[model samples]
Target: MDVAEAMTLLLSPQGRLDPYPAYERLRAHGPVVEAWPGLHVATGYAVIDEVLRDPRYVVSYEPLPQTTVAGWAESPAVASIARSMLRANPPDHGRMRQIVAGAFTPRRVAALREVVTAQAAALVAAMAERGRDGTTVDVLDAFAYPLPIGVICALLGVPEADRSAFRTWTADLTVVLEPEISEAELAVADRGAVALRDYFRDLVEARRRTPADDLTTALVQAHDAEVGRLDAEELLANLVVLLVAGFETTTNLLGNGLVVLLGHPAHAAALRDNPDLAGAYVEELLRIDSPVQVTSRISSVPVAPGGVPVPAGGEVLLLLGAGNRDPERFADPTRFDPTRPQNQPLSFGGGPHYCLGAALARLEARIAFPLLLRALPDLALAGEPRHRARLTLRGYATLPVTTVTRPHQATGVEPRRTVATTSAERRRIARVSAGERGTPTGAGPGTP
Candidate 1:
């Protein structure tokens, strides 16, 4: 299918279940395929990597025209968020990232592992308590989606009572890939933005009155020390982004990783048997079904992504999802094999614009995955899994699962199932690193 036709499938409800074939068609066409008149898409591994690493490929350019989303036009909250590091380039992006980076530092992320483990265990126990024996549970609602969201809410000091309402706002804002979002959707997005802002305004006020040992309080202190570093609006925007990004992405990662595992029992059994393989298994899962599928960029100057020249101001969609499944780069690319030794994937983007929350996201997944598997060895899909409708972030809307009862113990252990890592795994990692994409060791327990 052509890029336009593929986009139609992509936007349609059914396409979410299987976007790979369409992506493969786009990749087969060339490195660069124009999805829309002003938009160019890079699908292959090399092309996506090149554009991501290219300094000219602007990170924060406005992805769509003004008329695309009415909420973006009407809401200053939306604009403030769009003005964040994700949409800004160079000095601004670097400055914004640095301010927040201290909190998400490697050490801080490592420290968060204990928090993640405790949270995951508590959540699983809660799920068990609320759900009866063999009762159906929506993984997305109960486990997958809630894990990271809960952690972030506590970290950001968002009150427990407001999270459900705030989640609605985040969901409405996430459907930005639409060509023309309706006035209703725009209103939803607008209201969500307002509610979040109001909530944060109150939060900022509380922090100022009585400082706490939390990220928001620290940021408020920084703002006071250095004027223009952050304002009420920017602070709220970053907070909202942190919540949305943390909640949605890691939820999908856990959900999708579980899906991949259940499909491959041997790997699941191996993980159940040998806990040491937890980190490697997570990396392979990330490679197979990346949570953040595509990241958009804009060309500032004349540039060619994989020899396809993109004019200035043109849009480029780096299909990291597709790049991860390229046959040229990975052997049996479509297979869900945990033992893939050369497991380098662009689930996290490349270069200066690489995901800062990557560390936290990985930590959440690593801790969450093992805990779930250990809690319910017989856990499997209870019903059909429905994926969320969006080409941008690939994940499930509802993942129904049933957990089998297992007696609680001090330390859980199971049979070991070992499979050698494929040669393709090492090569893929080397290739991705040679291009300066992602952190070393592919993915570890603490972070990316």
Candidate 2:
């Protein structure tokens, strides 16, 4: 396919379901191909990596008045996402990142290992209980969705009862992150943004009155500190950014990881046999099937990536999903190998834009996956998995899985096993197990 056809396919629901072939076609055309005037697509591993790290490349841009809607431009969702560090550049981005980082310290994230393990185990046990009823459990809801959301809510000092509401708000608000979305969707996102902002405003005030040992309280204190701190808008925007970024990608990672493991029994067995390999397995999963598929950067000045000149203000779409699977960067790029050596997938954008929550995401996946496997050894697919029709942030909409409970041996303990059996059983299982179904299942080097 030509660049135009390829770009069209890449954005379609079917394309989002399996964009690897299109990526390969694009990579064959060149590392950097112009998709349209002033818009270039980067598919090569080295090129995407370089573009992300290049100082001249930026995330912020000034929208032309002709292209923007007057009132829509000022919408809460648009304003918050646009002003947040995720979309900012230079001094502003650095300042916002620094202040947020002060509270999101490594020590603080590292301290959540026990919490992640317990939460993962509890969720998996709950799934196991559902399996006992002979009912298929939606893994996305029962396990993948709750784990990261729970952890992030706990970190932010959000009450458990309020988390479900946040989940709905985040789901609606996340559509704003996509480059292509409907006006109707934008309206929903705007409402979610306003609700989130108002909710956090009250939360921040409460924290200020009574500081607590949580990131939200710490951020509130930083905002109210003597000097060089966040303004009210910046504080609220970053908190929203943190809440969404913290869980959305990690949720995808958990869902995609399970799909991959269940599809490859050998790999699943390996992980079950050596739970310590969870770290390596998580890395490979990230490399093979990244949660965030694409990120863009704008050229601040004339610059060349892959020896092709991009003029000042040109936009380059970094096809991170393609970069992770670039043949030159990975051996047998299409294959999922948990034990692959020296894996360095750019699932997380490189340099200053590298995901701030990388460590926490890794911690969640590492602790959760092993606990999940150990808890539900007989896990198998129950129905066809559904993919969310999102090209930028790829993940399952629903993953129906069942845990086959085997008869206990004389020791009153059931041995670990997989559940693929007869033609009917296999058919039912095959309907949802990654490769067996039409769903795209994989991720890149880190939990995005």
Candidate 3:
């Protein structure tokens, strides 16, 4: 199938698990192609980077029917949540991004280094224990999904006790990030919205009463006389955005990173030997696998960049993962080499609205992955790992795996039982290695 057709098929439930080959085809067809009416797809590296840096291109949904009509009409609750920099265009985007940036300064993220590392260690320990019974574990549910939620909760001053329920709220609000949806999905979206608003309202009230040092309180208090203070609606919206963006995107990164590591044992061994390499490998993983697979933008005026005209009000979908792997930009685009120096991957995006949480996401991955591989060097997918149902937000629903060493052994204590495997199991692993695979299952990473 052609790139457009393959993209359509990949968006279907059947192809979500693996859409990489489709992305390759799209990249080959041209740097830019039309996915559908009012929607153009850009797969080339320079084009994708340009789209992000271009001041004319807007991120606001106000111009698109997706946000103005279907998005808000179906779920009225999104009005407040979607007003932040994430969904805003230029001046509005600039203003909101500035305020949010103050709260998420690189200095602040740097302070989180030790805390993130500790969290990684603890979660890896828990995962190792959970697999003690010789039962397989889904990395998504067990570790990758929870790490960022917990970290963000800690940063936002949301009590650790509420992490689980708060995670559900994050999940519900991000459903729109999926490829396509039906009217019934809107109802579900409503429940998610209501739950999210209520949770944030209560949390906001608590923060207001006792002005703590969390991001929410910081935003509420920063500037003269709360100049940038968000009302209850705006507060909830921004919180939902932070939670959803920080939570899912990092999870996809960790998940996709693990898939890459497991698929390439040499890299895995290298990581096992030099945990410090994780600092650089995380970017390459994100570059090669590109956790955030696709980015959608709208053209404001008639502009031609790649022999393709994007008229006013037209939509463009930048296949960032494809761009990162474009052979025109990177030699050996298919290989997952962590040592590449020119790793200028657009995984965290480019330009003004680039991911505010990029630093935090990288910190989480760098701390989490090496710790995980060290604890369970023998970790491999247990069942036929499957991707989630959604398309817009790429990631796996399940990644069942059996750790090599027992919990005790993994923790550097004495082994309670020998890590066992048979010749047949080795052959099965080899078969999996040799099989012809398409794209990865799940949203193609970088989903939030």
Candidate 4:
């Protein structure tokens, strides 16, 4: 099919399931395809990378709560996101990120690594128990959803009971992030946004009354300071963003990663034998099938990537998933090769607006995948998978898998799965023996 025909199919249900073929057709034309007037779609690795890193290209140049976009304030969902760092540009983006970056610092993430490891173990054990009777369980429901959401809620100090509600809220709130937002979708999003705002508003006050040692309290303290580091509205907007982003991407990653690894049993066995390859395996899976697929940016001035021209004020919808599998950048991009050298995929995004949760997401996958594999060695797909019918945050809606209960120790328990001899030891093998890999940032929350 031709370029426009391919683009149409991409947005169709068929293309949503597998956009790679359409991506190949688009990329063959050039690095940047002018899909329509005033709009360009980037399908190549180099061009997408350039667009992500360049400062002149930004999420939005307009001020929030004051943007000229008509009826923006009408939808609480739209208004709140506009105030978030995801929608901010330049000085404001930096300032907002600075205040929240503390929670995801190396020190904090290192600490969180331990928490995630424990959570994964618990969930895996539960999965083992559930599948012990020889019945199938939804992997997405049993493991993927709870593990990441529980960890993020722990960080944000959200109660376990309350987290169940957020699955619906986040789903509704994030529909606003889709490429085309219908009026019906906007109404649902507005309701979801209100629910979130109300919940966080109460949580903020509770933190004020009695501060806790969690991200929410830290943010509450920052907002209430005399300097007014973060205003009440900004505080609410960011908190909502964090909660939604914290789990959504990683949840998708876990689901996507498991479906891929389990489909290739040999790879799963290789990982089970060599625990140290966890990081490399996780990274490659991200490249092959990213959780967050497409991101967009607007140019403030004329720029050319790969000598393809994009005028000032022009918009480009970048297919980040396609960039990860670009043939020029990755030899045999369609195939899974964990040990590929210099493997840097635009999964999390790049430049100043790179995903803040990249490391946490990486660690979660690196830890969870092996644990699941070792816990349920015979894990295999139980039925046909159902994917979420959306382009931006692509993942499985239902990944049913059957499991075989493996033998346990004399204590009638599976011995706790031990990691490598040491943390440094694992990192050593992952980097030196497997291949050196660097985190490449691009089009995560930056995408819409």
> Best candidate per TM-score, number?
4
lDDT of 4 by residue, 138-202 (tens): 98888888877776676676766677788889888887777666677778888899999999999
Highest lDDT: give the candidate number: 4
RMSD of each: 8.6, 9.8, 10.5, 6.7
Cα deviation at 436, candidate 4, in Å, is 32
lDDT tens digits, residues 359-382, model 3? 778878888788788888878888
Which regions of candidate 3 deviate over 4 angstroms? 1-7, 61-74, 222-224, 227-229, 404-409, 412-448
lDDT of 3: 0.68
lDDT of candidates 1 onward, in order: 0.69, 0.75, 0.68, 0.77
Candidate 1 residues lying further than 4 Å off, grouped into runs, are 61-65, 68-71, 177-180, 407-448
lDDT of 4: 0.77
Tens digit of per-residue lDDT, candidate 2, span 61-169: 6631113444567678877677677887778777667654533345545555655665565566656755775789898888788878776666566766677788789
Model 2, residue 380: distance off in Å is 0.5
Clashes of each: 4, 10, 14, 5
User: What TM-score does candidate 3 get on C-alpha atoms?
Assistant: 0.85
